[model samples]
Each structure stands twice: as structure tokens, then as C-alpha cells.
Target: MLTKFSITRSCALRKFTFLFLLLSGQILKAQSPAADGKSSFTAKLINIEAATTEVFRYNTTLHNGDAKSKVVELKADLPIGWMISFKADGSQVTSVAMDAGKTQDISIEINASATADPSKYKIPVKAVSGSDTLALNLEAVVKGSYGLTLTTPTGRLSEELTAGSHLDIQLVVKNTGTLPLKDIDLSSQLPSNWEASFEPSKISSLEPGKSQELKARLKVPDKTIAGDYAATFTANNPNGNAPAVFRIIVKTSLLSGWIGILVILLSVGLVYYLIRKYGRR
Candidate 1:
């Protein structure tokens, strides 16, 4: 039979050995790095129909024992028909295009008319084979608010008007580019002694291929001069102020009194004298 002290000692030794083994196993596990620790998205633009493409990608990663591993995911954002053109000198801006997700990188071709063909184009090699591999088509559909605009309206003024009269100024604001212009401020530097008033001094918006009518009333002072009046109408740009010019002339009624009658009579008498003398000669 084992003594009580001997039995106690044997149980203590077993417990110590088990604890040491468990600790050693944990240390070894800690040293190993997880194989699947990160997940991210990578995108590349491939030209298919347009100039440039904006691409978005997503990646998912999971780390666990064979049966318990889970996947983390990320999404890709790829726009269609987006393109960028570089300047030859590398200083000046050539061209840039954005797109929605329906398109990849687009091939550009100069048509007989010099317009880019969106339907028949291909992507460049560098864009497709790149590591990102995400294609985005950012063909700008529309940007900013629009109604009707005129790029030619800057620095434009109507002809001079008589004093206290309204001038029908036909200002054309065109959508020179393929964008919309909104809520533009219209202001003017009226000619000296002239008051320029416009209806709807502030526009609501301007879309492509549309126009607005600005009824302007011009008032010239009685003391105004007959020379050209320089009036500058300005539309302040987000970048700078665009300007237009108008001329105004102050005019007066002609005199039809004794002076006018005398002038007519002198002309008639001179003509009669010339006819008589020539006929006799």
C-alpha cells in the first residue's frame, strides 16, 4: 500500500507536467502568422468603347482552421467609358473624361469629322494588363444644375439707345461645352449718366442649347453726351468674372425752325441760279 504522502506527491507531479505542456503549445501557436489576415479591392480600367474608364474592385479574405475559416469582403467600383489624354509637352492639359459603371477603358479614334466614336473603340494594352485590373467608365453624363446658357454672352452689350428709352438687348448665353450652368449672377457697369436695369438680374439656371430673355431698360440722362457709352455687363464665374459691353448714344431732336427754312431756301436759290447761268452760256 502507498503512504498518504507518496500519493499526494504523485498527483502534484502529474498536474505540473500537464500545465507545462499546455503553455508550450500556446507559445508555438503565437509564433505562426495568420495566412489570410487581410482583404482589399483592386481595379483596372480597360477601354472598350470610350476614352477612359474608372474601375473599382473588392477583395475578401478569411482566416481560420479548414472548417471554421470566414471570408471578409470588399467591393469594386468600375465606371464605363472614362478616358484621360495627356499633353505632348506634359504641361498643358489635353483632355479628361469620366464615366458610369457600364463602360471600361475606351479606344479613341479620329473620325472623318474629327469626332470620337464611342460605339467603335477599344482599350489600350497598358490599361487592361495592369495589376489593378479594374475598369471604370466615367463618361460624364451631366454635372451641375442646367437650364440654358451662353458662353458667347460675356462682354456683350446692345447698341446705344436714346435718352430715357429702353434698349432691347439680345444677350445669347450658349452652352459652349456639354455642361449645365445654374443660378448665374448678372451685373453691369452702366454708361455714365445711364441707368441700366435688367429683368431677372439673377438667372435660375441654363441648360444646353437653351436660351433666356433678359429685358433690359436703359435710361440715358438728358445731359449725356452723343459719344459712345461704354457699359460692361458681367457674369461672375466661379473662377473669374466674365464681361460684356454695350454702347449708348445720347441723341436730341432736330431743329425745324427759321434756320431750317432759310437753309432750304438758300439751296433752292443756288440751284436756280446755276441752271439759268449754265443754260445761257
Candidate 2:
């Protein structure tokens, strides 16, 4: 009942089966590497960055890594640990377009946080722009544990800085937080009806334990109203836009004051005569 031929054939078959499995594994090993072994995941959202004025905006776009027609849903995914800030002032609607049935690129938004640098306060965007629908949770947060404290610029302005006068308004941006401040953006609002220009247009950067110099040119009109005026300002790093308001007080020259007086007199006389005649008593 035991034939040597049959037994030999079975053994041969078993050997071949073992060889096949071994070779197949080698082929798979040569083909691709496991993602977890060396690849890194996409960046995740931690905080919502924002601009002080709603008129300004921050945005970015992403593409679906898949090559075929795939359904993609976009959402914001916030990191577990961070101080998040949410304000309704930054709600500006937007739209994104993609190639039909092809690449998947979705736009992501970084919102403004309550405490962020005024100049570089930008939120990094991360979302699943892939074949699967994604629900992302995003929010705003300050930069460091001991975040930068933005001081609102405060000071007294000069009265009627003469026309073509060098306009140097001193402002103090202090480090109110445990951490330091750097790369600050200092901007001043011109008088309501006044035209002025800054030497640098903008102060590029500043660090904690330091104060920066900024100056502008105030060109008064020949008929400029010489009196007290004020302008709002901001000493900002991207963290947040703190308000710096200053008083600009000025007085017209004697010749200019005389011209103003003459106009006032003529106007007062005209008004008085008109009122006297119109006395419908």
C-alpha cells in the first residue's frame, strides 16, 4: 500500500509550496515600505490665528493625495493642548474650486486668536483633503505658555506740529508677559483729515527689553486748522493688535491765526445782519 513514487511526489510538492511562500514574501518586501516605519503624518491644527481687522484675511489650500474620483470633506482639527480663542468678528465667507474628478485641493482657514502677535499672527491649517469625508476641529490660542502681552500704545501728541515738521511720536511696547516680544509691527493712524507719511512706513522688528524708534512727516495745509487733534495707533506683533492712542496738539502761526480770525469775523457779521433783518417780531 505504500508506494515510494507517491511518497516522493508528496514530499516534492511540500518543498515547492514552502519555496513559493518564501519567494512571495521577498517580493513584497522589495516592493514597498510600511508607512509607519519612516513616513510622517500631515501637520495638525493647534490654534486659530487671526488678523485684527476683518478686512484682512488668512487662507491656504490642500490637494487630495488620491488620484481618482474621490469624495472629500473638509474640516478643522484642533490639537488637544492649547489655549483656544474664538470670536465672531473674523467670519468672512469664502469659496474654493477644484479640477473635475481629479485632484483634491481644499482650502483651510486659520482664525484669529485672542492672544497672538499682531504682525505674524497666522494660524497653521491642517485638514483631511482625501477620499474620506473629514470633520476637523479648529480653534485659537496664544503663542507660548507665557504668552506675549501686547501693550496698547499710549502718549500725549504735540500741538500743531508745524507744517513740514519732523513728526516723532514716542511709544512704549513693553513685555507684559513672562516671555519676550519680537518682530513687532508699529502702525499709526493719521489724523482724521490730516495727510502724513512715515520714514519707514513700518518698523520691521523689535525684541523684548527694548524700545523701537518710529517717525513720520506731517504736512500741514496753508489753511490747516491749527488746534488739538489725536490719532489711534497700534504696537503689534502677530499675536494681537493692541490699540495705541496719542494726542497731537498744535497751534497755528500768527499769520495763519489772523487769517482764521478774519474769516470768523466776516462769517459772524453776515450771520448777525441776516438774523436782525429776519426778526419777524
Candidate 3:
């Protein structure tokens, strides 16, 4: 009878221990956080290609996995002469507030140097909330930018000339871009019966931030009326073109002015004589 009682007590103790362990495990699991609850930073499009003159944009998301809200700061490592900004909900911001298990959309805007060479650049970005941090890598492929400016050395686009005479005006062509310009042809549009010619009418090549001086010869017909005329000068290439309008004031010659005075005097004398003779008759 004693042995049977001992055996029964041992079985009951084992069952109680097993039940206790099972209940403990269940309680621990209920209190523990979900495995999927973790902070993350991701970008929808991490790479882009554009001209150096354009602004680059990247769309991204920041997620908070903690059970509490937090403020996440945004930052980036950029090249020299570059600019960067972060935007959330169409407003510029340096940081964002995110709720637990929630996500926030972000827009990154970057501006590369106007003189940046054509190449691929890597930009590392980060989002930090207290002890936890997330990172994302981005790329920008810059392309060549072409630009030109046509003007005069003094920035004056006007000149005076005598009728039936030719005038030489100095002009400047500048490469106002990040890349070299080649095969640039110079041309002009003049008034009817007027003529224009350019010295060194074609430029083989022009480096960035460089300027070349040339001369434009303009000729006006002998009978062209004395007035202000419009002329357009153009510098064109396969990549780009620039046009400048110049005001050309045409004036009669000094000799022509003297002849007009003489004619007026003669007409007055003739009129006076005719009036005197006719009145007497």
C-alpha cells in the first residue's frame, strides 16, 4: 500500500511540473514583441540619369518597428559643390516623426554642380532614430550640358553707320556650359539690300568658360533711308545656338546734309523772285 501511494505522488508531481512549464512558455510568448517588428529604410528607385543642369530626385520610405513613436533624422554624404534636401508631405524637412509599425514617404532632392563632369556618383543616405539606424545607397549619372552666349565685348548690341558705308563691329562668342563646343557656324540676318560678312565665319572648337572675338562687317545701300534698323546675329552648332539682335542706326553722309541745305536756300530764292514778279504783273 505505501509503494503504490509513492508512485501515485510522483506521477502527480511530474504532471504539475509539465503543466507549469507549458503555461510559462505561453505567457512569455504573449509578452514578447513580434519578429517582423523592425526598423527599415528603403528606396523605390535608387539610380537615376540626367544632365548636370537638372535636379535629381529619389523616392524612399522610412518605417518604424518599435511599439512607440520616434523622430528620425535624415542625412546624406554628397560630393563637393553639391546640394541636397529632404521633403515629406510636400514640405521640406530634415527629420520625420513616425508612429510604431507605420511608414513615412520621403523625397530626396539633389543638385549637382553645373561644371560636374559626365560620370556616375555614389551618394550614401541614412535615417537615424536614437540607437537604431538605417541606410540606403543612391546613384546619379551626370550627362554633358551644352550652352552658348553671343554678345559684344562691351555688352553693347548697337552701332551707328553711314549710308553707303561699311562698318566692322566686334563680337564675342562664349561657351557658357560644362562641355566643349565644336563646329559652331556664324551667320547674320540683315535688312533688305543690306549685306553682312563675318571674319573667321566658323569656329572649330571652343572650350568651356572660354570666349572668342570676331568681326562682323556690315554694308548699307546708298539709298537706304536714315533710320534705325534691326539685325540678328547668330552662333549655331549641332548641340546649341544663340542669337543676338543689334540695333543699327543709319545716318546720311555729311555731304548729303550740306546739299539739302543748299537746295532749300535755292528754293527760297526762286520762290521770292517768282512772287515779286507775279505780284507786279
* Candidate 1 lowest-lDDT run of ten: 96-105
lDDT of each: 0.45, 0.47, 0.92
Q: What's the lDDT for candidate 3?
A: 0.92
lDDT of 2: 0.47
Best first by TM-score, ranked: 3, 1, 2
Candidate 2, 116: how far from true, in Å?
Answer: 17
Report per-prediction Cα RMSD to one decimal.
Answer: 15.7, 15.4, 9.3
lDDT string, candidate 3, 1-281, tens digits = 57988999999999999999999999987775443578889998999998888999999988888888889999899999999999999999999998777778999999998878889999999998888889999999998789899999999999998999999999999998888999999999999989999999999999988999999999999988899999999999999899999999999999888999999999999999999999787
Q: In model 3, how large is the Cα lDDT of residue 219?
A: 92
Model 2, 143-193: lDDT tens digits are: 432233323245444434754344555445554442455566656676655
Per-residue lDDT for 1-281 in model 1, tens only?
99999999999999999999999889976774333422222223222221212221211111222222232211222225333332212332222221211111222221111122224333221222213232333222122222233333454444755544566565655433334556677777875566767677876666645666565566667555456667776665452345666655655424424666889999999999999989787
Give stretches of model 2 more than 4 Å off. Answer: 1-158, 162-166, 180-182, 258-281
Query: Model 2 misses residue 262 by how many Å?
Result: 8.1
Clashes found in each candidate (C-alpha, N, C closer than 3 A) = 54, 34, 0
Give TM per candidate: 0.39, 0.35, 0.81
